[model samples]
Target chain A: MALAKVYVNYKQSILNPEAEAVHKALKRLGYGDIEDVKLGKYFELTIADGKSKAEMDKEINQVCDKLLANYNMENYHYELVETEAAQ
Target chain B: MALAKVYVNYKQSILNPEAEAVHKALKRLGYGDIEDVKLGKYFELTIADGKSKAEMDKEINQVCDKLLANYNMENYHYELVETEAAQ
Candidate 1:
């Protein structure tokens, strides 16, 4: 079986409210050394089938492109992992 | 200034609802080599301080401990990076 990971994040320089809130809280807590913050989402999946690794990769990529990811303002990237077949 | 990253994931044995859904969808589309799925969250922050890297690390750790991370059913770890001081 293969594993896949999809990570989505706002592009750098884009102000992130989530990060900003955390930064503010940190400052209020007296650790005022932080300047900014950003957040990201991650998705992982295990692939099982009789297909080739390449086929799995293509399918995973499609999942990302179609539903698992949103590209309106966030950027999405993914990694495909191949593991030793189980005994 | 230092940069911080927090990565949180469900424990290995924990069943992930999000991942299960993705696995089923991939199966419906064919090319299903996936057996499971899991999800994670990521946080990044840019810290600016007159303090040393060690000090920043300490503060960031505190932030993690007090807030900024949810430890219930999730495990979190962080990395601290010191960037070249802006000239």
Candidate 2:
């Protein structure tokens, strides 16, 4: 099997109000040293391993573009690791 | 400054309906090679650097336990990196 770890985050130009709220809450909770907080989505995908690395990369990118991320506001990147096949 | 990347995910015993939904969606969207999908939360925190590595570790753990994760149903882990101090 292959494990694809995808990270999706808002674009730098986009304002993330949810992250701002979390930062405020953290400060109120006495974590005064936390200067900034940005929250994003993480996904782990277990894929059937029969394709080449280049093929997997292309497919994963297509998945991200179609479902995992909003091209206009968010960006995504993924890392693929080959794991032992399920017993 | 220091950068702390935190990842929070549902415990193994917990039923993550959302992840299941995503998995189904992926299949319906033609990503048939995707065997399973797991979704989680990721956070990047920029913190003022005045503490030793040990101190930072303790503080980050406290932050995760108290606010970032629900100890009853979720698990969290973090990585810390020393970055150039914010101007």
On TM-score, the candidate that comes out on top is 2
The DockQ leader among the candidates is: 2
Per-residue lDDT of model 1, residues B29-81, tens digit only:
76445566677887877877588777777777777778866566677788887
Clashes of each: 8, 1
Place model 1 in a CAPRI quality band: medium
- Clash number for candidate 1: 8
Give the fraction of native contacts in model 2.
Answer: 0.90
Clashing pairs in 1: A46-B34, A46-B35, A47-B33, A47-B34, A48-B33, A48-B34, A49-B33, B19-B37
Regions of candidate 2 where Cα sits further than 4 Å from its true position: A85-87, B85-87
Candidate 2 per-residue C-alpha lDDT over B1-87 given as tens digits, one digit per residue, 9 for 90 to 100: 899999999998899998898899999998899998889999999989778989889999999988899999999989998898652
Considering chain A alone, what is the TM-score of candidate 2?
0.94
Writing each residue's lDDT as its tens digit, candidate 2 over A1-87 gives 999999999998999999999999999999999998999999999989789999999989999998899999998988999999741
